[model samples]
Target: MSLTDSEILLLEQLIHDREVDKLFSRLTTITEETNPNYKLLFEAINSQKWGFNDKNRPVV
Candidate 1:
């Protein structure tokens, strides 16, 4: 799928903010195999809301 300027900007920002690294781990050559941690990270990023309170603040 093609991405718009805003999407690209957000992606760039995500990287700049170090959110991307926290989202996905090492790149995989084979789609069938990947680190389970990466999957968990992906789910966390896409989840509706972060499982934490503002005052407590959870580590990403």
Candidate 2:
């Protein structure tokens, strides 16, 4: 599925929001960043729910 320009901007806005900082930080951390959970991370990130065009709310 392809995303339009607006959708890309929307997700970038959501990801940059302060509320999502913790998860972003964790993903950048040493241990977590090197974990084998890369598959899950890749899946979630590639999914429409967390990618550039995702419209769903993130599970808190």
> In model 2, how large is the Cα lDDT of residue 12?
86
Stretches of candidate 2 exceeding 4 Å from the true structure? 18-60
Per-residue lDDT tens digits for candidate 1, residues 2-59, read 9999999999997777865644544423244766777676666677565667788864
Give the CA lDDT, 0 to 100, for residue 58 in model 1.
65
Q: Candidate 2, TM-score vs. the true structure? A: 0.31
lDDT of 2: 0.69
**lDDT against the true structure, each candidate:** 0.66, 0.69
How high is the lDDT of residue 15 in model 2? 74
User: What is residue 42's positional error in candidate 1, in angstroms?
Assistant: 34
Quick one: best lDDT, which candidate? 2
lDDT of 1: 0.66
What are the per-residue Cα lDDT tens digits for candidate 2 across 12-39? 8987896678878666564644767775
